[model samples]
Target chain A: MDLSTLSLGQYTFVQNAFSFGLAVMAAATLFLWFSRSHVAPAYRMAITISGLVTAIAAYHYLQIMLSWEAAFSAVGGTLEVTGYPFNQAYRYVDWLLTVPLLLVELILVMRLSKSETVSKSVTLGGAAALMIVLGYPGEVSEDAGTRFTFWVLSMIPFIYIVYQLVVGLKGSISKQPENVRGLINGAATLVVVSWLFYPLVYLFPLIGLTGGAAVTAVEVGYTIADIVAKAVFGILILTIAMRKSEAEGNS
Target chain B: MDLSTLSLGQYTFVQNAFSFGLAVMAAATLFLWFSRSHVAPAYRMAITISGLVTAIAAYHYLQIMLSWEAAFSAVGGTLEVTGYPFNQAYRYVDWLLTVPLLLVELILVMRLSKSETVSKSVTLGGAAALMIVLGYPGEVSEDAGTRFTFWVLSMIPFIYIVYQLVVGLKGSISKQPENVRGLINGAATLVVVSWLFYPLVYLFPLIGLTGGAAVTAVEVGYTIADIVAKAVFGILILTIAMRKSEAEGNS
Candidate 1:
């Protein structure tokens, strides 16, 4: 919400977070791509989509790193704004594209009956997009009232996604091979927990946090959550796909 | 080797070339990754490595882009040097890494006997690396003697690789499934022609070409060669893999 001079330590913290995000997302994308043939044909598209999500994330992370460098110059003891506004919109743009695909990839890998897959994909994908779109205005707003309003608006879709993951996906996940049921449940939990971290980070400025502290908090926080949500979640999806492929004697 | 003010048209030509290189590499990486599952498991590594080669190229192209933008300022009718050096090393570094893997991936997908695969991969991979390493001296050196000396040395491994692709691989190509034999032959031819483009481009500075025209010529020329070598060559690998998979009844 406001610019503050950053101590070198504070600037490096966010810089490392974004650079690490790029590396992890890129590595995960390739690993998923290379491992795609290990899954059954029915679930291969899910693995492909997982790779797509991470590749998209990797591209954004690269842009984020550039924007971070452009916005701050830590020349001596402190990091000062270079008057190039940090393109924080890269994060929202990434989320808008990937969040829906994340939901779709999970649904696809479950190998749900066609009608159910199509229905759930549409519903959850729409909710994810809505959540991101509603959150952006709030994310960029400086006024506490406007920010809080969009936060509340955004939470509506967030809760819906959570509900779908916890309740609606329960039966489908149950229908997964017995060996992967626990992993599936863990993945669903991961999605909820990691996704939840974003809103908490979003509220940092609204709380007492401000200036470098608030900016660093949100940057580092959101970067960590994104890595977990995409990289970790993609790994879980790949593992489940492999295990299910084996369970089905397709491996 | 010397800086000159560039007309806006000259600057945009090179800038667009680097940007296009970045986009093409990124797209090729994703395409190869998503198509990996379409091939039989035995051939999937070739497809996976194709993704990797393109991905590595993409990363360097991103860096090259940053350096290109940083090295020039075209605020008016002319583009002027910005005191930052254009990171031409990124291109050589990329070539060093991907060139070896490009050879190895081809050897791998041929499904030679284990011993033959190992032998060819080692020899060809080593040759590719040496070619790039040898070429870099000439690539960066402005001295005519130094550049010409390295050029001749680099061509040693280049000719070796082309020989292996043509002579040594003839039997291997003939042994391949009939459905993919034509494709294999074409791939070998593609490698030779594309790689030949590099040395010609490398000679640009050695010739009468100078200043921005020389820079633009080499940048655009090398960018085209790289795309054809990695992206087009990679597509051939994937097509061969898919055809071989189908012929083997493994698809």
Candidate 2:
């Protein structure tokens, strides 16, 4: 269950997944930051928040990757795992930070009133962070029942987050320019759909894939979801903000 | 290596990667086909080509995934890998078909003169397909020298693709409305940068990571590039085409 026990393949998959995610987060952070000049001033805050989300994720993924490397080095290349440990807590720490900022970026781009934005962002962001913190225990649990329990508990906040996005934000989304409304809705849809992968990934072990298959599925699934949730979704936000910025500039 | 030797991690990774690519491609194809009401008639051809690129890749990825499944079924939980053969040619085949179409999609979006569009698309598309065909032999080569030689050959065409996008297409891109021009340029840059990963991935084996590390880097790297080149870039193209479509409607 530790570094020495992992096959070279497992190690490589985990290592590459984190490294690639880190690279993407870093690149997206830079892109979001530099794109400010091309967007309207009103949309700058959203852009900043998007950059902050990826920047934070990049730092945390680096920590996770380094932790993995340290664990791997402790055991060398032997396949008999004894006590080498990796710190998966880094991922929880990352989601705790990035997930909230993700919601905030969405809210800011919506251009809601100050009070409405504050209330909505705080509520949704809190739920997002809570979902991550709550899911961690489940992810590391050895007992399937314990894992499922934490998963169900995490779903409470996840459902609320989805509700807030799909229903709670509907009015604001509908009010956007017709062309952009589809994109805003699409962004929200992406959040809901991509996050669903987390729960599915959590169930990999329950279905009796406790070996490399389960691990591979979980790591690869999460990697794909993370890219979609963070980078791809970030681009969607940029598009929305850019269109809005241009509209304002022209008018 | 054949199917028998592939680790569960490898099987799972390949299966998941192809499946996910298929889903993204299918979704994009549906989106393009259904969104005709939202785009100008002139832009629809570009959108359709974007859809075609994904559609072709999707079909190929499905074949790749099915081949993996068949290979897995043959082994039936025997950890020792044997003579289960899975064809990687599926990738080369897919790329050969889709890469050219990718360039054509870009050329189409420019709304250049009929003769100019046909000439540029044919030239660029041919170069893109040749790049893939030339690289395939290197990918499967045993000797580092042979791989490098083929890589250099591939790069010749890659360099030409970049030149075409940057210099050859400059006039058409520059003539776009200011805002859309930025996106069009960004799209061109996305092609250049994302394609750069292909070469770096090629160097994985030369760097002495010839085992799981090499395989991991190549697969994960290509998956990331494919997403950017096809899905992410397709979205950018859609954004540009949509904006131009809207401008036309308004004017």
Share of true Cα-Cα contacts across chains kept by each model:
0.06, 0.00
TM-score between candidate 2 and the true structure: 0.57
What would the TM-scores of all predictions be?
Answer: 0.55, 0.57
Lowest summed lDDT across 10 adjacent residues in model 2 chain A is found at: A78-87
The digit string of per-residue lDDT tens for model 1 on B1-251 reads: 56565667877888899899999999999999889778888888788888888988888888778777877777865667765456576677678668988887788789999789879988999999899889877866768999999999999999999999999899888888888888889988999999889888788777778777777878888899999999999999998888888988998
Residue pairs with colliding backbones in model 2 are B3-B84, B4-B81, B4-B82, B5-B81
Pick out the ten consecutive residues of candidate 2 chain B with the lowest summed lDDT.
B73-82
Q: Write the per-residue lDDT of candidate 2 for residues B108-215, one digit (tens) a residue.
A: 888889999899988999999889989999988878899899999999999999998889888888888886999999999999999898888787777776654455
Docking class of 2: incorrect
Per residue, candidate 2 scores C-alpha lDDT tens digits across A118-229 of 7998799889978987897787677889999999999999999999888989888888888689899999999999989878877877877666556655666777798899
The interface root-mean-square deviation of each model, in the order shown, is 6.6, 12.8
Candidate 2 residues lying further than 4 Å off, grouped into runs, are A1-251, B1-6, B73-78
Off by over 4 Å in 1: A1-33, A36-251
Question: Which residue pairs of candidate 1 clash?
Answer: none
